[model samples]
Target: MTAGLSRRAAICGIGQTEFSKESGRTELQLACECVKSALDDAGLSPADVDGLVTFTMDTTEEIDVVRNLGIGELSMFSRVPYGGGAAAGTVLQAAMAVATGVADVVVCYRAFNERSGMRFGGFASTLTSMPLFLSWYGPYGLLTPASWVALHARRYMETYGVTNADFAPIAVVDRKHAATNPDAWFHGRPITVEDHQASRWIVEPVLRLLDCCQESDGGVAIVVTSTERARDLRQVPAVIEAAAQGATFDGESMTSYYRDDLTGLQEMGAVARRLWSMSGLSPDDIQTAFLYDHFTPFVLMQLEELGFCGRGEAKEFATVENLSIGGRLPINTNGGLLGEAYIHGMNGITEGVRQVRGTSHNQVDAVEHVLVTSGTGVPTSGLILGRD
Candidate 1:
């Protein structure tokens, strides 16, 4: 077996800008703001940074970040793709860099003006990534992310006797956590199952408006360094117990429609296999979790895919008493994408760091390890974070 990079690196600091509909600034400014904030939190300066990582979709380039931050020559400048799937992969990249001596002190960031700028909620012809699906969907007026996810939701619900009601607890508890998080854009706006049922349908008979995540304008960044080095830094290190990125066969950019089984996140399943093997930890060991909430149905799929519950058993497992702050496994305590602003899942990583640091607004007690995932459906990645 390979000596994986488990506990080789740790997230020394996490930072984010305020979640808002309109930041009234360029994406570059937002990126710099969060990176600087993260460095400040890590007791490091811009010059201490030698590596940088980000999403392929981010508007701010790596060189731009280096120039703006006055960071010197970088040994590593990499980008991860597949939108939200790249969230945890960024840290995976940084952990590898630090472990292999590629660089020291890396910062992973995602910043966007998605709401006041280019919105991801609505469909755009520019997204020709899934050519075959786009051709079929375009002619049938099936546009937007909700409709794309609706394709899988329909099959999942039909195959497993699931419904929109089965998905409401995730949305309800997410907003409930968001209601307490002051940084959450939807703070103070907790919703009930009745409210979720009353919301308008974004995709008929499948997804409601509340089931979809918000198109937010914000930025979040994480500072990574060797675990030994992190101990001397300003804050407690959220150690990288196991960092993994997985992309199974027959996966596309935004859709995994052609997979043999349309009911589960197979790529995330691939990630889970690596995580468990590397960390030597199981679902039972996870104190809390941050399953990607770009959509709520995927949250259920994630619970099953990660082996927290058996396949098709999430319908019974997804209760407020189960997933709440005092439950068997609290999830998305910072409200998640549905409640917090979607920095394309980067904000979820920051919250995982917070939970590990014991600084979260809805902090779970005795959190020895926190499981954080990237996007579902397509090629995805996940991380098992723990206290160092």
Candidate 2:
């Protein structure tokens, strides 16, 4: 097993504002509210917080959040890149800082007004920086994220003999889980495979309307500190068993079209290898998972990449019986991004903490270890959280 930084830190607090289509509050306000709530949940004050971490895509600056929340004397602050892929990476940064004593009481947060303010699925007003790669695909109408992923999804179907009908189970299961979760936007509203098939096509033959995650406006924060200190805190410590970020050969933003295989996420596979090594635990050890579900096809790819099932077997494995509670592996108990609100994946980490703490609305029996992953098709990250 890989050594050095396993089980050094733990998440003692998780807090979030209500998920909504329109928060009616500034992103800064949403950020500060979650940060304060997380600190409160950890039985800590802003004065005790010494570090901060977030995504580079986040508009709320660290200094701005610190100043707004009255946090004093920041010792460490950092940001990860690649949009939603930075979710678990933020916690990795905080855990590393706390583990090495670079900082204590580190808080990782993500707050955005995605739905009501700026939608990721919407057209960009202007190009901030045009990389050379954009010249190849941008002119061909491969503009939005859905279109980018649809290109990969079509190739995956042809390579694996996977079909559009195969993706129905994923959507059905996610909404099934979300139906019981009151916090989910689709709470009490479950969809079937028929419902999935009836949904309008976003791209074509691959991505349907129900397959994409919601553009949500919300905020989520996690408090990380030493396990020793966390035991004395308000919540049960979800120990950081392992954490890692990975990018495979010839990786590009989401346009890694040059890879030998489009059916698998080699980047997440690299992350899986490190997590198991560092934590001294395999996929068998995990009782639950919060696999990033930004897109249904990517969820299947993650299942294969993370080794929960064999390559090209994710569709067969993504059954309602398999994904439900009391089944082999329960995923996205909080409804995932598709059913739940997307706080740029910070909410997924919060759900992982809930699993470890045995407090999920759809709580699995005796969940000692929970696996969480960030966005796929980019430089991504993953984490293993276990009971302390």
Each model's TM-score? 0.97, 0.97
Clashing pairs in 1: none
Q: Model 1: per-residue lDDT, tens digit, 1-388? A: 3246999999998888898999999999999999999999999999999999999999999999999999999999899988899999999999999999999999999999999999876546566565565776666766677778889878999999999999999999999999999999989999999999999988878889899999999899999999999999999999999988898888766656887799988888999999999999999999999999988898998999899999999999999889999998899999999998888888888899999999999999999999999988767899989998
| lDDT of each candidate versus the true structure | 0.90, 0.90
Prediction 1 global C-alpha lDDT: 0.90
Candidate 2 per-residue lDDT, tens place, 42-101, comes to 899999999999999999999998889888999999999998899999999999999899
Model 2 has an lDDT value of 0.90
